[model samples]
Target: MEGVLELPPNVVLRAEDLSVVYKMPRGIARVVDRVTIDFRVGRVTAIVGESGSGKTMMASALMKLVPYPGKIEGRILFRSDLLGGVVDILKLSPKELRIIRWREIAMVFQGAQNSFNPTIKIKDHFLDTARAHGLDEKIALEKACKLLELVKLDPERVLESYPHQLSGGMKQRTLIALSLLLDPKVLILDEPTSALDLISQKVLIDLLKDIHERYHMTMIFITHDLPLIAGLAHYVAVMYAFKVVEFGPIDKIIRNPRHPYTVGLLKAIPPLRGELRFVKPIPGSHPDPVNPPPGCRFWPRCPLATDVCRKVEPKMVEVEKDHFVACHRWEEVEVSKLWT
Candidate 1:
């Protein structure tokens, strides 16, 4: 399995055979399947998939924050500077995990409104987070102010105002600032541009790009938007039905996607500047989580699926240097004109 192989030195975090299962009244729903992927240091990796493809669940699993009733199984090895070595997040105690949450890895959740306390002022949020992490109040305040400014918000005004007083864009930017307060090495953002206007989305995207260039932090951006990652991500991991189907450098994935699902995603995106072409949505709905189809979960929707694909699960295999595809007919997919 890819999880057992020796990882490159640059890998800051790795998830090996990671799976998330929820024992609901209906049945066992595996939101995240046995997946293994490496996150390189100082690179922006985008986890792209449709809604309910387990993007958010996998991100939560990385931070050991899967809510009750959802059990995570597998190794989430993080190269921790605090521990002076690699540590499996799932193995860490609650206290140890708390120490690492913001100081080592922070998450900017999807909804900015829900992330903040309505009654408290913005500065209090910063101070509260710092206090929880045992950071000095004075130093934390200074850093918070600087981060607010970095995100193009006025510290004086933002710090005094409540969450309701800020615009959606302001709140989103503030959330980003708050996530950076502890200077975490890895930042996970779930649907960062959700519920934002076009202008706000563009601004947030630019801010994220600037933040990455300035800090060079390892970032995991979870979004279904394919075009959005084109301008932001260094690497792309395409997930389908709770499993990563294709992963490679952004350029390679964009120019030559080798997975049928990935090609479907690209074709679904409407082009703004190019020859006119019909936009075709990927044909089937997402698989039922509790009882997905047998063998290759995507075979039902995959145009090139053969008898083998319906009988045996395809393992992720290297199609090119640093590029992988988990498709039984990847060679046929590579030469197909679907995406081109």
Candidate 2:
């Protein structure tokens, strides 16, 4: 179990029993299991998981942008000072969702730079996105300049450059600028620093911290990089096999994670200032989403799993004050050695 960081009453977004199912010729595959989470205003919550763990799908479901042939279910509630009331995103019509997309909520997608058209200049991309939301070219240009500066980019040079002319870092910064063009309250960043160099990744991390503090925006950072989130995020959600196995404050999770899956993940991180030691990766692969095993999703790879783990589904339990773990043998598992 980990410790919980209680947020203020001003919650910007919440997902209740959120699930995404894909329709296949054989049968439906549930990619994102029933995940419920509250993203507070002005707080950074990082959702960390390996590939195929449904982290990106969770972000996609938040924006109602899940790929076609995939159907989303459950309540995605969004409350903002701009909206003046709590709105259920799943219930919103396509037109209404569009209204909220950039102005009220924005997403910086994974490989977002690749989404840019090679033929178009970066300035046109920003102008076009802004114009779609009804802003004049003049206003769009001014906002673009300001956002580029906020992201530590030279507005003049970046705006004039094409997607291919800029470096990877510059392209990423441009995407960030575009996402903030409407000053949305909630920004969902899906692997914002994925393919960049280490230096560029650090720069992006610093820029994100600045943006969160400056705009007081609720940022949901989706990535598989657990180490990167340690200092940057206030809260963390550990997902496996499409479900959240453990979640709480960053410090609590780092110091006292109760879930075996979470413990395995922490063990895999190489310590920066420690005696050189071998890092053990989590054993076994994540279950197939379409034909996942019964009972606890992590049971197959969990070392402490028992007979009960193979039969009854383990409900999420509060093992420590505000710390939740969804494993029957959480108390018996000893993972404290990883941190020490």
lDDT of 1: 0.92
- Cα lDDT tens digits, model 2, 159-255, are 9988999889989988998999998988999999899999999999999988887888889999899898777899899999999999888988888
lDDT, residue 49, model 1: 96
List runs of model 2 lying over 4 Å from the truth.
Answer: 1-8, 81-83, 337-340
Report the number of the highest-lDDT candidate.
1
Cα error of candidate 2 at position 5, Å: 24
RMSD in Å for model 2: 4.3
How does each model score on lDDT?
0.92, 0.87
